[model samples]
Target: MTITYEETRELAQRTVVDARYPNINIYTLDAIWVLYDRVLRVDPQRIDDPARDRFLLSKGHGPSAFYAVLAAKGFFPAEWLDTVADLESPLGSHPDATLVPGAEISSGSLGHGLPLGVGVALGQRATGHRDAQVYVLVGDAELDEGSNHEAIAYAGAVGLANLNVIVADNDSASHGWAGGIASRFAVNGWSTATEDMHDHDALYRAFTAPHPDRPHVTVATVRT
Candidate 1:
């Protein structure tokens, strides 16, 4: 059951108790839903499979969207959406891997996702996992973190073919990149691309593009 943007948004809205922030990054959520629906590999019955695709939400501050998608995908109960951030709820502002059924990592402290994704991608290759793909979603502002640059350089150098990064570019970076985010990755040997965040078809194509012997990055631009 592929969830549409409208459906995902409605599901997410159910979890929003305060309208002030909505506790979700709507642009990133809408963009990423396409990747999960059209590109990511998964087997609810075989999550432990080494070849099963992994998705790490590096932009974790606004997790209502993540929880909504997970619930829609049957990662957990749909009812859990209403309980998010409540006292008994396992779902918090930032996803906790041990608590969230489908989350690969617990991330909120910026600049950690890409590095962790690089590690996952490298490990999968070393273990001879033929088809696993490791994906990380990051905010444009998070790129300011030096740790991400180190990971980007290392992943590109090692030719992490199984790694993919989707940077939600909302122009929130205090010190923005000169030639845009794609250029940074390109210089480091990554196969890079950019597309409007609202264009699901374009995003799908970019996200699925082949980058043999190199890591891939797709920057989805969102209006701030």
Candidate 2:
């Protein structure tokens, strides 16, 4: 059963209502939904397959959007949304990779996802999983972490063509990038695209655009 956008929104709202933390912002909802519904090649059933695309949610503090998308995609039961953050619930404010069916990593510690994604992309190449792609979704504010800068430079230096980064820029950064977030990646030899985060078709095109010899970064600017 294919879940429509309206259904996905309802699922997110359900989780939001059950949220115990104040950070359950649904800012990443549209981008996450678009990725799972249109772009990513990951399957809910074969999550452990080496050929599956890996999506790491680096900005994991507010994960209601993530959980909702996973549920809508059949990665887990929608009922879990009602119990989110409960003592015995698998769903928490931060997603647990082991607890969540399709999660690639246990995140929430800002700035780790991109670095881990670089390692995962390298591992895929080393293990002959050439067809797999590694994607990391991060927040603009999380980019303030030095670890991400290092990872961005390293990934670019190695020409990790199989790696893709989606930056959900809500302009929350303490020190904004001079030429915009996309320019930071572009200077590091990455193919870059900037689009409105709510523009599904534009998001699809940017995500699917080829960057043959380099990694890619799609800057999804959220409308305020």
Give the TM-score comparing model 2 with the true structure, all chains together.
0.96
Clash count in backbone of candidate 2: 0
TM-score for predicted model 1 compared with the true structure: 0.94
- CA-lDDT, candidates in order: 0.85, 0.88
Instruction: Provide the RMSD of all predictions against the true structure, rounded to 1 decimal.
Output: 1.8, 1.4
Q: List the residue pairs that clash in candidate 1.
A: none
Error of 2 at 49 (Å): 0.7
Clashes (N, CA, C under 3 Å) per candidate: 0, 0
- Best by lDDT, which number? 2
Clashing pairs in 2: none
Please list the residue runs of candidate 2 whose C-alpha ends up more than 4 Å from where it truly belongs after superposition. Answer: 17-23
Single out the weakest 10-residue window by summed lDDT for candidate 1: 17-26
**Estimated TM-score for each candidate:** 0.94, 0.96
**Candidate 2, residue 153: lDDT:** 93
